[model samples]
Target chain A: MARTVIYERVALIGLGLIAGSMGLRMKRDGLAGEVVGTARSAKTRDMAVGLGLCDRVTDTAAEAVQDADLVVLCVPVGAMEDVAREIGPHLKPGATVSDVGSVKRAVAEAIGPHLPDGVDFIPAHPLAGTEHSGPESGFPELFDNRWCLLTPVTDSPDAVERLTRFWRAMGSNVETMDADHHDLVLAVTSHAPHLIAYTMVGVADDLRRVTDSEVIKYSAAGFRDFTRIAASDPVMWRDVFLNNKDATLEILGRFTEELFSLQRAIRKGDGEMLHEYFTRTRAIRRGVIEAGQDTDKPDFGRGTKP
Target chain B: MARTVIYERVALIGLGLIAGSMGLRMKRDGLAGEVVGTARSAKTRDMAVGLGLCDRVTDTAAEAVQDADLVVLCVPVGAMEDVAREIGPHLKPGATVSDVGSVKRAVAEAIGPHLPDGVDFIPAHPLAGTEHSGPESGFPELFDNRWCLLTPVTDSPDAVERLTRFWRAMGSNVETMDADHHDLVLAVTSHAPHLIAYTMVGVADDLRRVTDSEVIKYSAAGFRDFTRIAASDPVMWRDVFLNNKDATLEILGRFTEELFSLQRAIRKGDGEMLHEYFTRTRAIRRGVIEAGQDTDKPDFGRGTKP
Candidate 1:
């Protein structure tokens, strides 16, 4: 199965789920001639080499991106700047540098100034992940049919197109948006929802009357989904909230207002209002299914889609 | 394929997911000699008969419960009293009466006094359902490996045991608790989570800056699960919030307090506190999986579980 290679060499600055998955998929698709990777954790670096996710496991970010044509920063949002500073002078001339961070504006603000002028800087985010993280949690099919948004702060059409092709070859649908809009969209779609899930799980944990055992045993009653969302990598989510503070807080404020309205309706026995609100939300779920973003089958088509 | 029958006649007073599943399972298992069902909506009654989910379909609640050895009121919580009043005099002496409302204490209060002295009243809730509703939305395996909780206020051990056997035959594990405890437990597990989900989805819907198309298209980023839970039957959830007001409000208050603390942590750039809070909740998700309440497979095990 021969295919056109998108890049001569690819360097991943972090060997976590997204980067590991990128390595596996690129290798499977023969998208790059050589793949080099590194991580701050020796365990992760060792696991990447052992799993054969990359052709070369480098000792430092500077060494990894030395001659790579496509370098991706896959570290937590908070660590992006330091990594960019370390690797800036070592980046190959005319090479494209991108990232898979959740918050775009913050990533641009943190890493943009550290990149060298000759290197093309384009930030991206793949709106795809499981709760699991680290090098061991990746799979080749993690990005199949998933959206990958490119929020390029630099005006480099050729570089952006090249990065888009790489993601498309790895089974992702690519869309480009500005940094600020991407962050706001994500705050609504991912950040606020994750915070709400985390808070709900925390409240359930803190309730003394509802024993931990009871909550765990009866989680199938809709609480289990919240638990699953809240179980995501803590460091990634922490950086997301810290970086996208304004959008997250704004969305949360709106959430609180909506919640209070529903609470008042419940207290006043306003069944009509409650019913209307609940019924309207159902239409959005249908739209998601129709848009090919999610499956409409019962239980998320679990137990059958594979 | 002969098996010992649990009851001669079982009557389901509503034809929604729970009752529809119960009727289908009973017929498939041959646990009841005849299953009778009726719904307030003519369309639902017609669909129940068309699907052959029950052996007989009645036009009225009184007719449905005429000689039923077991009468299960599967109506919304607010309608329990009216259904009980209409069916009370017609229930056969020695019949075991029950309901499948999420709010057990309110259900017991609404339907208890209307029951005849000779009839045993036990309120039960089968903690199993898909987002779909109506008679056609049910299947025989809906209750498989799920829990059916019975909260009986009566002192009839024999009747309780009989009802337990009935649910077990339908592939549900049974547990008995006092009504108030059941209400509180459900408030924590089901009601509050649902209200929060509905609120989050509503907030997304109301955000003018984020187009509905964008929200629907990018829902896989954790918002889709909330929409799935919020897509549940509106009438049923409205009744749940109204009937279980005290416990639901108490849990909501706790959820708001926890959310505000996390919001402050985000605003103050306190990643340490955020990470600690997020990491602790992952353990509960593990507990849920270990308890066999949910699967740990990525994406809710949507593709491989079947």
Candidate 2:
């Protein structure tokens, strides 16, 4: 049986939305003994302190993890390895190291080699967020009931269980899977959908005859939904795209092929094909509702055209 | 000056979400002297009567419109002309016939010739609806703070003004514009957005590599928003697609060209292009929020994802 433990000292190596939320949650729940956070900029460190995101804030990654029992690398996926290396020598022996990056496979490979043998390296993703980002954008309830999936290496039961229990203590249901599986699942569920929304917004913006003002003015019927998702943090998403290149590209390839077929049907005025396609798509939405992932209501949180 | 003449023995044709909502609003505000509604099916007519959607309900359009001062056509855009043709001879002289169809030009053009010379025809779109359909789905607050656009061609100013007042009484902002303009605006804001959402869902469904279970799960990031929009009344949307073909196609043409360019940039691994396009789209969402068209808060009505 795994022993129950509250982290004596936790170091969060980023000060953005996810890290801020996790900090707030840890503080509110008293899940960690001491919460220390670091950012690349002194300005960010100051803001994190002002926001009370952690008990201590600093600019140096090594200093933040110097005496920490748990070190979480919540920076961008591309920066995970660099952060890991910077803090590698400073992390206490037998310390638990994890991340909150969206892409799992690359991050696992990138940061895995940087960790000392005594330190644990686990990759995790909290499937919770808003379109907004940064320390100010996060709320305490951001991860209250969301799924937190961990993609850990083989023969890592003890470290995986410890992280799982930690997330559960922070109000998340935990699941463990391989990094590639996590990447593929997220590509379909998160990455492809965001890309599609971003692409659609790009498409609307390209409308020469249809003025952008008109699009903005009348975004009620459906496009507003696309805009909400497209408005998500650019840097986070850009990093996500670049890091999860293989999985995203694979899903995107499939998407484009299907989209081409749809385009042909529309071009040929094949209403039957169009109708059938729409009908099939409708069932998937019902499944989403059934899976408790979506609401049947219009606009989700948005009220009707008022 | 606009007259205060109420619709005497008003006929509400094709009782569904819009017509039922109108009925409830009329009852709450006493907008009409009398309301007699008809439905194609006996069951729907009975539901309208049972829901108190009208003062009276009838199976036949002729019976419903008999001696009515105003007839509001609430059928789907595809069924508008047929309903108009069927009810044309029965409409009394000086009676104004209007509709709440989303598509304006074709609906107006199709129903215009069928009306008697002295009978007025106005095409109106009350920019409103929930995903739920049928008379039971309506409530008095449906039109509250909503927009009701009137596209009239040489109709009696007195009659148009009275209709405008009726919608105002139902708690809507009234605007008068040409049918073409209304269609063009809706095409950008509503029609193309719905189409793209439908297309995205279709793409997801066709992807053999992306399992349905995974798509349904982990959707909170963005895909869930598209699903909600995609869950709108399929038949109503089908009719909308048919009626507003030209403007939708034109906007779609522009959308496709833009999407192709974005796809090319993505394939070339150009992060700047991706970020620039995404960054620009955010301003429109801000504009929408400023316009009070959307809420900045996450649809809290949805509550925390469980």
Candidate 3:
């Protein structure tokens, strides 16, 4: 199937995994005539060009967005405002400005007022990524079958529709959600879970009794999954925790409360309660598999072959 | 490699994933002759026979162990003592008795006294499994390149050596550790981590705002991995927690303490602290990959292709 060119020029600010993959995917699908990208670091910009992640690697955000019909802010949550400000005046009058930030409400609030009147501020989060970052870490198929959530605070319906088409053309499932609701859902899904994984890994690290070699050697039993998630980009995750504080805290509170109940069950040797709790959680895993969100193969489809 | 047959008339006293896999692999490797199995549920025993998981499916533990050279207790941790007691009188002289239980110290304590004299009690835990269980879920390759830790509390060196060779022939790397230390190492590596995964999945389930469908759909971000670990067999996990209470709780206490600090950091908007913590945890993930315990491929090597 062929995709229409939704944008004459697409500019990606911050050539990391998300933006880099977006560029490659957009180019591969013929969704953009030209993909211009800029990174804060010169090394990243050079690498982006070397990897052919963009049609053109510009020196600055302003240069990249000069004639771009679609400008994506792919920087961390903390840098969204600065990138928006830098590219605001250079954005085409009828351009649709979106972001790939994980936290929607904070990204919208930070970059909302910075955009000019004629442009649209559609805060979006592509619910897809790998632990690896930078331009070389991305591939054209990264977003295929993954959801890209759009939280458009702008009143322009046409802009949202066009941007939704752009994402779909790039091999993503587009869904519109409210900014606050998106944050809460993401807090439930991504932010809080990452924090818990990080916490568990940290606890294992701090345990003096279990040597690091043992933790790493025997990780395949269960702890290895936590390590895979905890290996995500540190700066981006830190910003996510800082920006999505309230919702993350709320989810954590619920998590700790439930954990305490299970802990008490273990202490009192209440096998039935633990059994019931574990049984119920298994249903959600089945749901994920049925929804096609994950593979049903054992161990997340990891091979057992040597 | 053609593995040497280490035992004749081996009895597996539960037709679950571990025992079923062991039976299949032993047959594949030519490591056992006449692999017999028995399950408390007639349905499971029938299924094991139907799947050709064993040479014979006996009705009772006593019947299965008669004239057996090796008997493995593959039931849940809570049932170890009773199963041992039931099979004690029927065991052949100088038979090697071992278990595939997750927690070592507790299994030793429960089944040690029940074993008849002249039998060796060598508790072993194979750090390999999938989310699926039961007689039909066994695969001959499931233990390939995985760790199998043995905690031999008995004084029979020859018996321990024979059991180690048996596990190695089943396609696992064998290592020996003290039972108590084994519990503590696994507490950090497996038990606490599973509890946390279960807690997070339960919290996602309990949330009224985030519907179950949305969670299942967007689980790939992080929660999907938790769901995978949390989807383990309920009865087995329940017994693990109840039997390994002290060590799991100790790890959980340290876990909550670290979680509290991270929560405080998030509350204070301490991005630096979060970044530092996440960065340190990445080293452990790298170690896991380097040790061949897990793959370094993005998203646990899950494909991005649609």
Candidate 4:
């Protein structure tokens, strides 16, 4: 099928998993007439170009954003401000500035001040990823069927609509919401769960009685899922927790309280309470499946191999 | 591809996921001359027979085990004692009786006293399952490449050897360990992680600020994994926690301590500490993958669909 070009020139800064995937999808679907990508490390840029993730590679964010109609900052949440400052003067007038950060409020705060007056600053977050990272780890289908949340920071209806179309062309369902609400919703859905998973894996590692090998060998019972969540990019996650501190901490506080109550139930042998709580959680799983956010097949349809 | 018959007649005391899977595997491979299954619920018994999980279905455990060479209890850990007393009088002399309960030590204690002196009672647990349960959920390949831990409370080497071969024929790697050690190991790898998942999902559900629809729609961002773990059979998990209280409580205490430390780091904006903790946990994920306990493919190799 022939594709329509959404943007004449699109510049992607910090080519990692998210950016590389965007580059692949945009170039494959002709969503952008020209795609230029850059990263701090020379090796990553080389790899992105070798993998056909971009039409060209640049050594600097400033060099990449020149004359581009759309510039997306795809770096860690902590690095957003630095990239924004570097590329602010280089951005073309009336260009739409956006990002794929996990935390929308923080990204908006970081990039909103650096944009030129005519630039349309729209912050976005794609709620899709794998545990893998790096330019080589990306694929064109990463955004297919997933959500791309847009929190428009500027009064640019035309720019927001165009970006929505661009994301839809890249195979994402687009939705717009307030940046602060987005952060809080994400804290409940993503941030707290990741911290909890990391903590559980860390606890398993620190336990002297259970040897690491034993924990590894018998993980399928449940611990392996926590490990998979914990294996996500460390720098990315650290920046997330730091940048979105208030919301994540709030969710963690609620989680701790709930955990303690369940622990008390276990201590008291309150089977009814435990059973009720577990039964309640199953409905959420069904909702997720019904929402088409996950597969209903057992074990995520993982292949059974000995 | 001929399979040697390990038992002349095998009795399964409950027709749930584990029992049904065992029956399907044994019948398909000709590992047993006949597979007889019994369940308290008539609907479950009918479903098991309709699914061909057993050659025959019995209404009572006593009738199912009569003259059987092998009898395996596949009930909740809390119900082990009553089932043991029910079938104790009918168990054939020299029969090897085992169980598929998650908590080994408690199950051994629940079952050992009721068995006849001539009967060899061995408690076993397969570290394999999916979120779904019941008779209809069973499949022949459910135990393929899974670990089955046996905590033998008997002195008969011949019985233990035969049971070991029986599990191997059903496509599981069998290991024998002390019941206490098995309980502690499982507390770290399964019990504690499950409780943590349950708590996170409960927190998400209770946060009225984030509506249920939003939580379900955006769950792909780490929260969905917790929901899957939390969706497991509630009665089974409640029994596991109640029966394995001490070890699970111990693990939960450690988890709480580690979580607080990380939470403090987040509150203090200690990026270095958070980065170090997250990076350390990545090694465990690699270990789990190398140990073959889980798939290394991204997102457990889930299919991308809208």
The lDDT, on a scale of 0 to 1, for candidate 4 is 0.88
Give the candidate number with the greatest lDDT.
Answer: 4
Decreasing lDDT order of the candidates: 4, 1, 3, 2
- What's the lDDT for residue A294 in model 2? 53
Could you tell me how far off, in angstroms, the CA of residue B218 lies in candidate 3 after the best superposition?
A: 2.1
Ranking of models by DockQ = 1, 4, 3, 2
- For model 2, the docking class works out as acceptable
Residue B91, model 4: lDDT of 90
- lDDT tens digits, residue span A1-306, model 2: 233347889999989988988888788778888899999988888888888879988769999998898899989887888998898888788888889999998898888888787887778999887767788776666776678988876366887787888899777778888788888888877887788777777666666245646666555657767778888888778778877877887877776667666556655667677677677777777888787665565435322211
Clash pairs for candidate 3? none
Worst 10 residues of 2 chain A by lDDT: A297-306
- Mind giving the per-residue lDDT tens digits that candidate 3 earns over B178-275? 99889988999999999999999999998835554687777766788888899999999999999899999999999999999999999998888999
Compute DockQ for each candidate against the true complex: 0.66, 0.49, 0.63, 0.65
Considering the two chains of model 3, state its CAPRI-style docking category: medium
- Over B167-215, each residue of candidate 1 has an lDDT whose tens digit, in order, gives 8888788999888888777888889999999998888888745564788
Candidate 1: which stretches are off by over 4 Å?
A208-212, A299-306, B208-212, B299-306
User: Which candidate gets the maximum DockQ versus the true structure?
Assistant: 1
The candidate, 1 or 4, that scores higher on lDDT is: 4
| lDDT at B227, model 3 | 89
